[model samples]
Target chain A: MNLNATLLGELIAFVVFVLFCMKYVWPPLNGAIEARQKKIEDGLAASDEAEKELERVRKEAAVELNEAKSQAAEIIEQAKKRAALIVDEETTRGQQEREKIIAQGHSEIDSERNRVKEELRTQVATLAVVGAEKILEREINQDAHSDIVDKLVAEL
Target chain B: MAAEEVTLSSHIQHHLTNAKMCSTDAGLAFNKACADSGFWTWHVDTLAWSIGLGLLFLWIFRSAAKKSTTGVPGKFQCFIEMIVEFVGDNVRDTYHGKSALIAPLALTIFVWVFLMNLMDLIPVDFLPAFAGFVGETAFGMDSHDVYMKIVPTTDINMTAALALGVFFLMIGYSIKMKGIGGFIAELTLHPFSTKNKIGMIFLIPFNLLLETIALVAKPFSLALRLFGNLYAGELIFILIGAVGLMQLPLHFIWAAFHILVIVLQAFVFMMLTIVYLSMASSDNH
Candidate 1:
């Protein structure tokens, strides 16, 4: 081969081949690589986003749980207060009712004792008038003697 | 025309005349004569040898593929695996970021180019002469037209093709990594910039010119590096072949030296590809 021709041919061929390879082969190869890299980056981004969301949700849930717990505690406290109030009211009401019943029972017992004593006094006066009549064994007018005996009984 | 009647000096003259017809500055005349002489040509036989080499590579690798082991690999498999790993590692080291295509592309390039370069190890005249014989007997074609150069990497077309592939990849990766605006900015403002209005005025044109030159130089460098190595190796082989058959020791020595050339050329090609891709992927101007 002539050196010059060979060199020239080589140069020309080289230029053409370089152009062709750049046009056809390199793009897809590089694109495939870039695409894979992009996919990895996207995956990482998505994961990061998900993690952030998870953190936010976790915080929100925790706050909600705490709020719920606090509210529940408040409700329990309120219930306890209400129960104490009810017990206090009920105890006061029960004591007042018991006092009223006991006072009524005492008044009833005093009235019954007064009636029995009055009845005993009346029976004793009648017996005393009868005994005087039996023990004297003397004839007496019913009107005059009765008046005197009544006067004596009144005095006694 | 009678063989016995022709004097030795006259025979020499006749041969000289015939040789003269085959000589030209462009060597087109010689190429044509060689094509017409029914002995040696370039295209058809070179293509056939390329196909044959491709087939040989396929066959060898096919058998080797069957022997591939999961645990302790056989010699051939290990060798192939090592080559794959080496190419992979080179791609990983040179091209930053996640490269799905660059790695495999680099691997294929290494193996394919290496196989192509290995074709030079075959006796230069063997396949061509064999093709010549086949052309004369089986095909009944001119044997001279059957000239074949087996090593494709030695062909400027092949190397240029590889370089061009890299060039396009560089452009693509640059665009993807830098965006259109950024790419333009790199061209217009890189290596110098308008930090001050006075500096900007002076630096703008200069930077643009420099950047333009750099852009042009990129593909040229890639192309020349591959072509230079391959062409020089081809030239050495041709020179060795020209020194007559008696210089067997010298031929062997040259061939041994060419082994390094073959490997180095492939490596350079692969390395340049990675470099170009890396540059493309980089945000830095």
Candidate 2:
């Protein structure tokens, strides 16, 4: 129990050990713990951001799908309308062309019939003139009787 | 005749004596030879065990501290970390001051003192008997002359040294936080102050006496409490050893109980030191 050099030795040892612990031990361990805490927090925050982004992208995709579906339907409707209008226009043009062709054939037929009738009348007039010459025993002059022949043909 | 005849009293006395070494007029001396040596004498057993245990504390802690990581810890790492965290939490709870030294100082005291106290659990005669055998055979010295008190905390020199260190720190912190004038005023003022200036003049001496005794008693109690606890534990073990084969049950019972004292005393020493330093740094008074 007597005071001695052992006390001095222990005192020196205690101070040295405390200083060693203070300098080397405390800070690094505390730093590692804090750094790990920050890392975990950052990881959690990033996961949250990813979840929000996923929700946003999902919403955008749904909207685009709806828009594209409507756009396709509108295009199909326009094409159907255009096809119907083209069919109507072609039908009207075909009907007008068929009527005009039938009219032209009738005009050509009338022209042909008139030409034949004129020939027949000329023949009949000639024959009538020959018979009259034979009956009266004298000839008829063509140049002086043209107006009478045209009137006789017209009457026939 | 057996060259070594052991008596009941001498057996206990030998277990209690430290292996002392000091300079004498004739030259170098040890143990019984250093009996008349004064303050300069060294208790080699106490110095050896205390420093050895202190080094052990540092070595283990240093390795763990060196390899510590933020990732998953190994078993050894976790064990050391638990101790560090336990002491750190106690310091944070008890110590209100901002000094970086308090926590580490607390850690050192708890671990170091506990390690030294752990020596008490060893069979009482084991190390000393072995040391005496080595002395008798190797160095050709009488077996009884070679003493080894394995537990350092049982030695007053060891406990007093630690308490005195805390004592110095307490004073230093008091002076640092409250200047010398303030420290002096704190000692010589209040607890007996009055509105009367003449009354204040009369009260300073009484106040100084009370405060000085109170201040010095802090370290004295700290040292003696640890010393008394461990010394009594060691003495009981020695007495139990004298009972020969029948000592087994008694030793186990006492050792089991002493374990609580070992840890509690170390904890008490650490907590008191933090509180004292906390008070020293505080100006609340």
Candidate 3:
């Protein structure tokens, strides 16, 4: 109920406590709060950067896959063209070999026919001479007729 | 019957008195031996408990600050940060002036004042009765002489001291914002004035008188508001205790309601101090 020197003591205590609080307590805690805010902001930014990087890699992979697929298609196309050309060349070479074999066979057959015809002609001539000799021997005595037959054979 | 009435009145008186110490012409004195006009009187109980509570607040905050991290906070750090942020937010909202002192000062007043007011919730007779028993047994002093008022905010001196501190800060801010000349002029000008030189000159005294009362009332209201609320609550607690065994329920109910008053008064004190400083810092005139 009365004013006394206790107020002075309390006043001193209040000022000292406030000064101490301002110096010690407030700054570090505020620093920690601000630091945490910065840390969270940085974390979010890094995550966003990583997400962008992932998207870029995914796009690159898709492009490379398309390139590889097109290259494979081109190789298959070249192989098909080479196989078709080889088949065409083989067919042409086979046609030429068949023609040459046919020509040789025809030439051999012609030669054989000519040799048989010549042999047959020779045999016919010999047979005709013999018959004429038999006739001459029976009809007119043999010597003069034989001479004629030999001459005929020579002519044939 | 008269003797019982006297005893009851004395019980109420005993709860109201502080454990006082003061200087005398011979040497030192306590309580009744101190003079009525003893300006040197010290309320030892109020001083001890209030300062002790203030230190406890500092120690806890310091430890919390030490353990605080930029990462996930533990429960203790979380609770401490909540209170600090609460005061910081209030200061930021109420105080437009850019000074480092306001937030921490607000925190100090709020926590320190709240702690002092919290002492009212302790059973009214518990500490004083223990103090009396100890005094009678340990010291050879009469138990009647042991007056221990534990709730510091209930004492006018303690609240007045806090309010006076805020009052000084207000004046300092007003002076700093509007220099010495501007401060004096501000006190003695406007709120009423005239373009006429003679009329303005006549208005100066009236303005000074009105503004001075307004300025002085800040601290006066601040001190009495907290002291009156706590003192009334304490007196009622004391009165209820006189109801014998039934005091427990009534005491609980009153204390439950008083908790609101205790917290609200501390908040109001802090808010008013910030608002006053903000007003001082701004040169609206």
Candidate 4:
């Protein structure tokens, strides 16, 4: 083989092939690879963010649940306290009402007894006059009798 | 039988020679009929096959480029991608430079040289015989004079050319990175450096000689290594071809082993190119 011509030809071929490769082949393939890499990275990042957000939401839900539980406990505790207060107030009111009614009854009984006693004293005085008249059958000292009768009334 | 033996040996010899074309006193003639000698002749067969293979390599790659996608890749696309990625990875690992040219150059060298060397796998006698038959039957030319060889890498000139291209790039990158002065100084001052003036004066020439030999040997070794391997592989195939029907098993065995040789040579050529280029562009010196 003629060394010069073959060398020239091979050199030319190598340059042409290399130029074509740089222009056409390498860039597009490399671009595809880099794009795929970026896509994977972004996807991974998005998944991580989703996981973090999920964790945060779970924590918030737990906190809300705890708050709700405490609020419910507080409401129940207040309801129990209010119920006891209402019961005490009602019992005290009932006791006061019963005492007021009992006092009224005692006053009424005292007044009525006084009235009867007055009536009974009148009758007893009348009956005592009749008995004195029968025992003495004649005219007695009326001033003296009145004096007895006034003493008797004063005793009664 | 003796005449047939003579014809057979001559056939082998004719197949071995390049299909040389040159300007003669009479006119342009093919092979030994040409009057021109030395550098005037051209190996038309080597040029034709190597350039044709180079173009084929381009066509295959560019077609893949057009069809390439970021999504699911087809078989052809996948094959092309594998080759490109293989070369790119080697370049990324071995070549420390940031030049845009390195990866593509490595890819081209690997694929183009491989295609050239792959020609060795073709039966040596098949192509030339076919050409001879065509020449005799169609063109009514002398079949003996229609020389043809398909394996371009087997030709020393082609390997030398490829190596020299790398060598020139090495020089360019070296000068570009180190400056002409630094490059010259490196050529004179490496692998042996003395601070003293007297010591430097004594050492420069010896260092220059050694370093020059080393630099020249880079391309020399690169070219000769590939040429020697492929040439020996082709020679073994030619020798086996002389054995007639007995050549089948031997040819198969040698070809199977030679497949390793072919790939290894192409890989070695590309790797050396990357190393040489990286060295040229690096600053360790």
Candidate 5:
């Protein structure tokens, strides 16, 4: 075959094709590959961040649970102390009340005995005066005997 | 038997010949001065098919590039991507330069040469016969004068053209990367440089002679290697075609073997181009 215009034609065609490919084809393809790679990288980073956040949340929850447990125990201890103090206070008040009631009863009994004794003494004096009057058969000095009776009442 | 043998040899010769078009005093003439290697003579069939296939390659790749995605690729896109990746891999492995042109150049050479070489798989008489019919009907020319050789790589012109393109790139890259002085020094001082100044001076002409021959031989070998393989393969097809009915099975067998040769040759051409360009660009000469 003659090495004529065909060689030149092929050369020109090759050069043009190479230029076209360089200009139009390679960039977008490479861009797509790079973008997919970046997407995968970002996804991996996000997953790592999510995992860290989960760990932080878990630790925070555990700490909060421990604090709540200790506070509950403190509240229970305080409640028990308050209940014991209330019971002790109630016991002392009840003892005081019983003592006061007993004292009042003793005082009332003494007063009653004294009143009975006074009544008995007055009755005896009246009996004695009647017997003496019958024996003497006369009213012997009533004004002078009244003074003795008054003295006897004062002694009783 | 002698007549059959004569016809067989002529048949092979006929298939090997190109459909040449020469501008005559009267205008475009078919197969005029078919043996002549004049400036006006064009290998019509070779140019037509080669350019047609080159355009097809461009159209397919360009369209695929246009419709390409970051998401899942379609079947056509996948196929195009596979080819691009295959060629890009070779370019990456062999080409050391940072130029954006080399990879695409390698890709074009690989695919374009492959498409040209694949023409050999067509039955010997198929396209020529078709062209002959069309020529007779449309152009009012005799079918006998419409000589057409379908495979472009079988033509020395096409292969030499590709190889020469690589040769120019090799020189261009060498000059661009190493500077003119460094390139000259490399050519004149390589493969036989000595520590002794006087002795090295004596070695300059020897080195230049050998290195220049080596430089020219790169393209020469690249062209001849492809041309020889395809020409031989096409000749075999022509021989098989002359066997009439038995040619079918033989065609199948030869086609299978030629497929390997075709792909291998394309790969070799592309790899050599990349290697040559890399060597030109690298500082180690």
Candidate 6:
């Protein structure tokens, strides 16, 4: 077929088509695609940031937990030490109290025994004097009376 | 005429010809088929067909463009939008940097070529035979001279035109993207020689010749590829239809098969256009 007209027609048509499509078709389509791509990239970036945040929080929590655990251990150790010191102090105080009580009891017993012995000796002397006075009145001589008293006292 | 006892070839022509002979226009060779009256007649030529098809597609796309939604698209909108997106994505993948023209140009090439290619799907005899009838009835010209080819891409002129347009675009874009000096430098120094002056001198002439051949070959390849596919398709359809009444079923089957060819050819043309544009736009050898 003679294609001179056809060729010219096709060229004109292609030029018109290229112009028309450039004006109307490409913008929206490319916009939509680029928008979708950007959205995906943003979503991925957000996810990465969230993951990093999560990691940071986990580390912080671990540190806090470790600090809390160490503090509790230290408190427990302090409590144990305090408890041992209190027990030792209480034991020493109890022993001192026991010794003071024993010393006071011994002192009281010694004082009571000394007082009783002194009282018994005084009573014996008084009884002998009374018996000698009664016997000397009956007998009327000084030398005889003295000798009788001494013998009576000795016999008692 | 002396009958020199000629021996007939043993092979017999098939019975299908008898059926076709029955449908032959008895007076077609002798008949002075006329052209039709009215605007439709002028529009019957290749140029008119191209313009008309372009306008029809534009109208359809305009309507689709008007109904384009911000929300979820309807089925038709989605279909149209898919084509648009596909074209855009293809441009992005193939053509790098900011080619404001190439992407849309590629889109136009794709749609126009596709529509032109679709003309092959119309029955071979439908338009021309109808035009012949109309010519005889209306314009009072010979129907034989009406000679309207509906499938524009099948025509060498149409394919070459398209190729030439692309060729011009390639040149224009190259010049616009790469300055005249840069363009010349590239042609001279490319595909060899980075630093050495000797290497540059040796490679420049060879590269220049290769580049020149490549530039010429681009349009040729584009034109021939589309023309070859479409013309072959048109030929096959004509051949199938020539088998006449007995082969109606076979013709129908071949027509169905031809639909695949039509779409495939369109796609191939579109892909090649993208590739060529990409090549033209690039700095790489």
Per-prediction TM-score to the true structure, in the order listed: 0.53, 0.77, 0.79, 0.75, 0.75, 0.61
TM-score (C-alpha) between model 1 and the true structure: 0.53
**Per-model DockQ against the true two-chain complex:** 0.02, 0.47, 0.55, 0.40, 0.38, 0.20
How high is the CA lDDT of each candidate model?
0.63, 0.89, 0.89, 0.86, 0.83, 0.69
Put down candidate 3 lDDT per residue, A1-156, tens digits, no spaces: 689999999999999999999999988777787788899999999999999999999999999999999999999898899889888888898888888888888998999998887787677667876676566557755566656666766677
Candidate 2 clashing pairs, residues 3+ apart or interchain = none
Ordering by lDDT: 2, 3, 4, 5, 6, 1
The pairs that clash in candidate 6 are B33-B141, B33-B142, B33-B143, B34-B135, B34-B141, B35-B141
- Per-residue C-alpha lDDT of model 4 across residues A19-122, encoded as one tens digit per residue: 88899888987777667668888989999999999999999999999999999999999999999999999999999999999999999999999889988888
- Cα lDDT tens digits, model 1, A62-143, are 9999999999999999999999999999999999999999999999999989888767666666876778767764776556
TM-score of chain B of each: 0.75, 0.98, 0.96, 0.95, 0.93, 0.79
Clashes of each: 18, 0, 0, 0, 1, 6
Off by over 4 Å in 1: A1-156, B1-70, B197-205
Name the regions of candidate 2 deviating beyond 4 angstroms: A41-156, B1-4
Model 1 chain A weakest 10-residue run by lDDT: A1-10
lDDT of 2 by residue, A1-156 (tens): 588988998899889989988888766655565676688899899999999999999999999999999999999999999999999999999999999999999999999999999898888888776665566554566567667766876788
Cα displacement (angstroms), candidate 1, residue B155, comes to 1.5
Which runs of model 4 end up more than 4 angstroms from their true locations?
Answer: A51-156, B1-8
Candidate 4's TM-score on the B chain: 0.95
Candidate 2 lDDT score at position B58 = 84
* Residue A89 in model 5: lDDT: 93
**Positional deviation of residue A60's Cα in model 6 after best superposition, in angstroms:** 22
Best by DockQ: 3
* Model 3, C-alpha of A16: deviation from truth (Å): 0.7
